[model samples]
Target: MKIVELSMVLKIIPKVLQIFLNFCLVLLSLILSFLLIKELTMFLKIFMTDGSSDYKMFIANILIFFLYFEFITMIVKYFKEEYHFPLRYFIYIGITAMIRLIIVEHDHPIDTLIYSLVILILIIGYFIMNITPLERPNRQK
Candidate 1:
């Protein structure tokens, strides 16, 4: 009957979507790996260059390198943890990004203050998350 066929199609859709998502994630990991390599080379180049190199630019690039590294690590963690992303990695990324933003765009005092506050909030949140138990007793079987 058409109902049976429709039910079969519905069941297949989720599997197909999961496969597509996995493929996209793999492709993204590859791209991020290339970008991390490029960032490393650029960092080395900036480090080796003469005094003409901008210090702010150098710091910014280093932050960017770490950012790429963190993302790649997160992706690896994703596969290792059965496709689930831990909130800690996201917090780490947010903290790193906020620091990078502060360093690269401190031209405005107010904006810099706001960014600093945001970083503080993230750190506090991370601290709270750290202290919490991984599993609740009620959730346990």
Candidate 2:
């Protein structure tokens, strides 16, 4: 009886922890989204006041916004897909981040080359992941 009780408690502990972590993730995502919106608004305000049209800054901010949007999407997908995070979303985020970095800071030839290589690697990984097939459960006849 004690062993059974202990096993049940152990199982319940993990479930409880998972629930708590999920709740925390949701809260953090919400907060991050709000902060992103606030930052976007501030960027707009600065652009309006400065009157200096910097396309690079504009593009960088847009990319940053997409990053935040992607993060929210990942969090939502996590809940929707039974708490499993799809690898493609992470790859997409990585690609977007790399592109943004290159756009914002491509000063050195070597650094740019390295970033390009990393992006290529990530793209290949994404392609490979997409091509891989998931195993289906065997149904007994």
Candidate 3:
């Protein structure tokens, strides 16, 4: 009886921890989203005030916003998929981040080439993940 009780307690512990972690994740996501919005507003205000014609800065800011958007989506997906993170979202984030890096700092040819290669690898991984089939457990007869 003691062993059974201990086992039950152990199982309950994990569930409790998972719930707590999920709550924290939600709170963090909300905070990050608010921060992103504030940054975006600041960017827009700067652009409006300066009346500058620098398309690069505008594009970079847009890409950064997409990164934040993807992160939030990833968090939402974690809850929707029972705490499992889908690989595609991570790949998407990686690709976006690399592109942003290239756009913001592509002065060196070798560095640009390496970043491009990284983006290529991430694209290949995304393709493979999409093509792979998920295995379902077989029902016992």
Could you give candidate 3's per-residue lDDT for residues 25-94 as a string of tens digits? Answer: 9998998799789879968776887668877888888898899899999999999999999888999999
Candidate 2 or 3, higher lDDT? 3
Report lDDT (Cα) of residue 126, candidate 2.
88
Please give the distance, in angstroms, between residue 140's alpha carbon in candidate 2 and its true position after superposition: 14
Poorly placed runs, candidate 1 (over 4 Å): 136-141
TM-score of every model versus the real structure: 0.90, 0.89, 0.88
Cand. 2 TM to true fold: 0.89
lDDT of each: 0.90, 0.90, 0.91
Candidate 3 error regions (>4 Å)? 136-141
Best by TM-score, which number?
A: 1
Tens digits of per-residue lDDT for model 2 on 70-137? Answer: 99999999999999998899999999999998999999889888999999999999888878887768
Ranking by lDDT: 3, 1, 2
| Clashing residue pairs, backbone N/CA/C < 3 A, model 2 | none
